[model samples]
Target: MHTFAPKSIASHWRLIAGLLPWLLTGCASAGYQMPDLSLDSLLGSDQAAARGQPVADIGVTRCDQLTTHEDDWDRVNGVPPVDGEDIDIAAAIPACEKALAEHPGHRRLQAELARAYAEAFRYDEAFRLSGQAAEAGSLYALIQQGHAYRYGRGTPKDIDKAVNAYQSAAKAGHIGAMNYLGSTLYQRDGWGDRSKAESWYRKSANTGNATGMANFAQLLLIDGKQEEAFPWFERAARQGNAFALQQIGTYYAVGGEPAIKAPYTALSYFEKAVEKGRPSASVKAAKLFIQEAGDTSSRLSESERQAKVLYWIEYGMPKLSTRQ
Candidate 1:
């Protein structure tokens, strides 16, 4: 799984943590009314596919006495070890703890449990478990440890330690680590080198990491190489990256290249991204709606345009504000 910044609500845990407060406050000063739907329903049913179903939903009734030998244990775990964004942190603790007790040395399980701990905001336990998993040779654990150190989650914020952890994991062939390391180097400001960052991103992309592809394309775009960047962005979007999806939609809407520009196609992509929990897509959708309405050649009416803008403002503002 790709690790997003703390400010971003892309991860299930971050979304839940951030949204819970705003959901209660109502932000009345902003003149925004809370929706009638439960906070859980705010994300909608598509979250199952977006986040992955949880262990309980996968028919594993007992988190205790878990089968560590199962092949599924080696795969990446969604929150609470299944495909949903709404994680019950309190409930997940015991099951994950019991599994670790039984399997004592299972690296993947340790890493997954570390992620569970991290999501629950139990950073000390998350860091400890990540270390244990890393010692057991789990590359995923190494990445988790890097994140913990990077943001000072459980320990001091040490960029050097974070870089070391990511380098170790990337060298061991962890794609997520590779991409993250690239990003860290890219965003390190004065100490960061774009050329170095771009190389690492390319290396990650070569390994078929979708996030890496998106990152590389973004760098290309920064260099004004839109024609070269287009295919890479499309590739990442096909891999279900919401950022890439929105970027491709923006490209299509703006007509950078005559061959690919199409407002309807752009609208479809923006809608797809919005369903995937991307707040920017809502604003983009609003802009495109108004733009299409204003086109003298289009059949859309003024009323429809206002309705679309109003809908997105009502819908997107809450999410965008929470992220900010």
Candidate 2:
């Protein structure tokens, strides 16, 4: 781990979006709570800065042409599969099947076909494809296979099988699996301990996985271990993780004054995150700036950009799960 100054959050300037896609959802209006799992401050303070959107997952942009996305592509993965019975999905299965038949040995094609099957509600076919691909040990195959088992797409509900699949992916150095596995172990009575989570998180982080660092730090920050979490947040922020950037900025904004409602430092953090396009953070930061005398418009725009956040929210809305 390395260290950097917590200097002015006003340092950042470029307005262009980062390389990765953003996922956002507006937190329920004030008193409304998220269903099932506990969520405090759904649309975090940073998200509320401009549009104040809260996100359940990252929005995947069409950088790579995989019609099969991580979201509702597998309805069984708790993403509430897309309401197929449409022309697009109807056409998708045949295309994938054709690709598979020509080359049954093509694991990636097989995986894609499995996604097509799941989307079409052909559970049995999807399971067969996913299982075959996973056993072949393709990274994509393992993740999809794990999702099939974990989400019980075309397969039976088998948490143990899902865990095993995830472990296989992790062993193969799958970033998502590493993050998910760490998180899985973090919420246990005696099995998934925090230390284990941190260890797994570090492994993923060392490989430059931003999600691992951000989620790991988020857990630590919420647990009131700010000092320890600081480095992790910094690592992720440097990777252009807006959420982690906001967390670091918030740490400094709190004044380090020991119990004065440290909004000062938090204001700077909110500004940095807002600049990095955290809608909620930007809006909340604007409110804080006017109340205090900080330079709210340094790196951030005076005019709020609500569309990015709105788009993020709309894109991610379909994937929200009622199940914990």
Top candidate when judged by lDDT against the true structure: 1
lDDT per residue for candidate 2 within 48-158, as digits (tens), equals 232212112323312112334442112122222222333266566777676567666455566667766676677788888766655443445556666676667877866
Best by TM-score: 1
Clashing pairs in 1: 52-83, 52-84, 53-82, 53-83, 54-82, 54-83
Please give, for residues 1-324, the per-residue lDDT of candidate 1 as tens digits: 111111222332111110111112221223323223231232234421222122222323234223221112235334233432344456666777876687675666676677667776788988988777666555556677779988999888877667667766565455666688788767754333566578778877765566888899999989888878877877777767778888888887787462255777777778777877787798888888777754421565667667767877676785332110
For every model shown, the clashing-pair count is 6, 25
For model 1 the TM-score comes to 0.70
Model 1 RMSD, rounded to 1 decimal: 15.7
What does the lDDT come to for candidate 1?
A: 0.62
Candidate 2 regions with alpha-carbon error over 4 angstroms = 1-64, 68-92, 119-124, 188-192, 257-324
Candidate 2, residue 208: lDDT: 67
**How far does residue 150 in candidate 1 sit from its true spot (Å)?**
0.8
For each candidate, the alpha-carbon lDDT, in order, equals: 0.62, 0.54
Give lDDT: candidate 1, residue 183. 86
